[model samples]
Target: MAQLSDDCFAFGGDLMPVHAALDLLRSRVAPVTAAETVPLADALGRVLAEDVVAPFDVPPHDNSAVDGYAVFFDDLQADGETVLPVTGRVAAGHLLGREGRRGEAVRIFTGAPMPAGFDTVLMQEDCRPIKDANDGDSVAIPAGIKRGANRRKAGEDVTRGSVVLATGRRLRPEDVGLAASLGRKELSVRRPLRAAVFSTGDEVREPGQELPQGCIYDANRFALIAALRQLGCAVTDLGILPDRLEAITEALERAAAEHDVLITSGGMSTGEEDHVKAAVEALGALHFWRLAIKPGRPVALGQVRDAVFVGLPGNPVAVMVTFLRIARPILLRLMGAEESEPRLFPVKAAFAYKKKAGRREYVRARLARGEDGALTAVKHPRDGAGVLSSLVESDGLVELPEDLSRLEPGMTVEFLPLSEVR
Candidate 1:
């Protein structure tokens, strides 16, 4: 286990641009988790700590790409058909017993290693089995086939001594498969980040508990927990804490000593009942990063003792947006993973919209394919930060850049698909 510096998130700014805030996080944050080796089955979603080198070339030998007859290209007639004796046969994992001579075809199947003196293959369908003058096995081949056709060269997919997987990569299924291809039974990866998540507010209550007169069920805590798990963190559900400075401070101090991160929604706003900010400031340092982004503007980044503290807005939509765009990058860096921002794709806008200049906005939108097969983004009807249903009904967000103040129909926009974050 490792710990972050006390002043890692001490940078101060007001109404910082989204890019500037991200740049700060990237510059300040580093991995705090230790490395350990795990079996390939348990390595998925874990951050790789070592670079993997290919010990040998993929395929290991020149093989046929399809079931066909392997022969020297020169053996075929230039403009007509030529008959040749079928001397031997080869299948996957098998090789020709003897060297093949020119003007002879050898039966070969897909993945079968090509024999010596064979450079081209003709599909079995194109060649006709016929009888030669000796009445032995023979085949008729056609012309116009190129040299070295249907032959997969050694190292075609991966070369020996090449770095197949790099350090700090979050292991995906394909990454695991590549390691298996290299005969690796286990991989060295960074341990999962231990995280504690909670929500605060006197008006919030548990879902299963009896409904109070003017209270809403806690949703932010559950949502944050799910998001943290999706990022491969081992989350501790700290439950809901009332708006009391003593209780919040006690929980934060205890959790920070055991976890790598402490996440909470609500009680971040500056109000009389918002004791979270005061409690965090008492135990460690706290900084409010007022980003110039729509829906999610007031993001709190700081440290609770050695553990990183993330205070997100109470609104459901804002919590998700800030987590995806802001906190996600910070958490990934702390997990020893490389920067992997979700990719945004360009699509034509199906609705017109406008926003203030110099502020980035992410509009919830669904994608629709037009008759011409082009994708168009349809904005959701609701744009409130508290509208959790809007996020559920939408596919992803239509990102409006800081310089773009107005948008019209058919205009191109970048879309961040929800799947990318998951």
Candidate 2:
């Protein structure tokens, strides 16, 4: 376990910016568990543990691209129709040997192996039967067809001994299909991170329960759990904990002993009954950093024994934003994942917006094609962190930099697709 400085534990001030908070969290945490072998069918979304090299060519041999006639290119005379006996036929999964002599042709179907001694393929439409012509039991091949024009060369798709997939890549359906093409039934992948999630505050109730006055159902837990699952984590739900120090501490202790990381919402701010922060410090150490971002300003990060602690804000929208901007990266790193920057696309803003300088803000926006055939982002009507509905209606978030205070309509801004972040 890594220790934090006393200054890092300070709370209740100007929060660190989102980027700065991420840097600190990543710097202190390391991967908890590693290496596991999983069947290719079950490996989707898992991080690769090693590089995959192709042991054989993709197509494996020269084959016909279409149902056509495989012929010797030199046997055809210039502008003169020549008849050749179709001695053999080749279909997919069947091969014809090198028994064909000079001036011969073989009837071949699509995906069939090209017979030996044949260098070119003429389409079936281009050739006519000998019975209709002056020749007997033979076909007429036209001139001007290049040699080997329609024959698929061996290893054209993937060469032997070539590195097909690199280590640390998250396996997608296409990647799995590619691996299957190379005859791999299993893959080495990193073990999924075990995440324990909970919510704190007696005012938080389960959805089915009757809501007392001044109480709300806990939505952050579901959001956190879903986000963790999206990142390929095995999640353990700890439910909601009261504001009591003992109950919170007991949950933290159990979680630290079992999970790679422990996460919670609420009870982190500097207010009465905020026992999460205090309990975390008493159990191990708690570091609260101020993020210079709108909607999600205060984020608590620390270590509890062996488990990394991530305390998200109580607001539903804030929980989602902070989880994506802060915890997602650290979780990836802890899973031994290779770091790749989020894909950001440049888009023009459709409306004007105002914000203070020195604080970065992510605005939920719907993207549309402008009249100029370019992508334009229109800001959502609501910017409050509690407005979870905004995220449901938007495609992604438009990033406003820390130095810029105002954005005018038609101004260029960076758009980060939510799909890319997950």
Candidate 3:
């Protein structure tokens, strides 16, 4: 369970900006503080509970970067071609027998440690070997090559006792590989947050079931389950709940007792069929009623016992938009993940759009490369929140800030790709 600061919701007004609401949401919830050890094979997508310190230097020794000939810089001829006897061979994982005298070269392969007293390397391509046996295998190299040009220094990537990873970092593929490089067989990470997801509506039915008159198939719950799973949550699909306060409240109470969060769709509004808001109010507390955002204005946030609750609109596009913009960050914080804003890339807009100045809006847009070969975001043909096909047809969302009211073609705007938030 987590606690919030008392003044987290002090907006001093009815509606708040998107950033303001996000900051308030973040200020209230605390990250899960429990940890469990898991093997590195199962560490991907999990948040680290503690900082990981490197045990030793990455390479452990100075090594050659390429297959070349190792030589002492001082042994080279000052003004002319220098010839040296190929005294011994040093292969990777194998060492040379002894140090060579003046005017001598040692054949070295990639990843082989720099031999004693050797300070320079010459690629085999630049050296010509003499065929005469009297010289006992010799190479002639030109003078004036720089010292230490083809060597990789030890501790270049990671030094001993350095912090390799910070706490609350969501482990990516490269991060996992780094732990492996530090000789870590297991990582301590926060346990996945348990989420109970469902929907409430008499007009909604499962996709495989026969649709009744004036009813549509439920898509939000399925999509929500997938998104939660992507965020490394243990998701339990609770199916659809009937449009009754008792049924929704009972289900939410039971879920709150066993899970870390309860997520429901389509019942936060004031319609006669809406019961999720009432159910949460009866069992726990409702912290927020709506966000000042178009397409998904009726989003709700609350808590039931120790479990947090999120209520989303019924429109498919709005559901996706609100979840990405609002619920995703909150869920991540609850799972002990470090806060990270979704990445936004600046691109030119190819379509014109007009939106209200008071509400934050996200337009479904497809990206196209112009004749100048720059990516330009084009708004989808339809802007209806219920149009689920727009999400599939478009590449991502073009975010319009609250202060701006007009968008002209070729104007620079921030484009957020769909894959980034996921």
TM-score of each: 0.93, 0.89, 0.92
User: Each model's C-alpha lDDT?
Assistant: 0.89, 0.85, 0.88
Q: Write one digit per residue (lDDT tens) for candidate 1, span 113-170.
A: 9898898989999989987677799999988899999999999989999999999999
Write one digit per residue (lDDT tens) for candidate 2, span 130-182.
76464446788877888787999889889999999888787889999999999
Residue 151 C-alpha lDDT in model 1: 95
Per candidate, the number of residue pairs that clash is 0, 5, 0
What TM-score quantifies how close candidate 1 is to the native fold? 0.93
Model 3 score (lDDT): 0.88
> RMSD of candidate 2 to the true fold?
5.5
Better of 1 and 2 by lDDT: 1
Q: Model 3, which residues run further than 4 Å from truth?
A: 1-13, 77-81, 97-102
Q: Please report how far candidate 2 places residue 318 from its true position, in Å.
A: 1.3
Lowest lDDT block of 10, candidate 3: 4-13
Model 3 per-residue lDDT tens digits across residues 353-381: 88778878999999999879999998999
Model 1: lDDT of residue 226: 91
TM-score of 3: 0.92
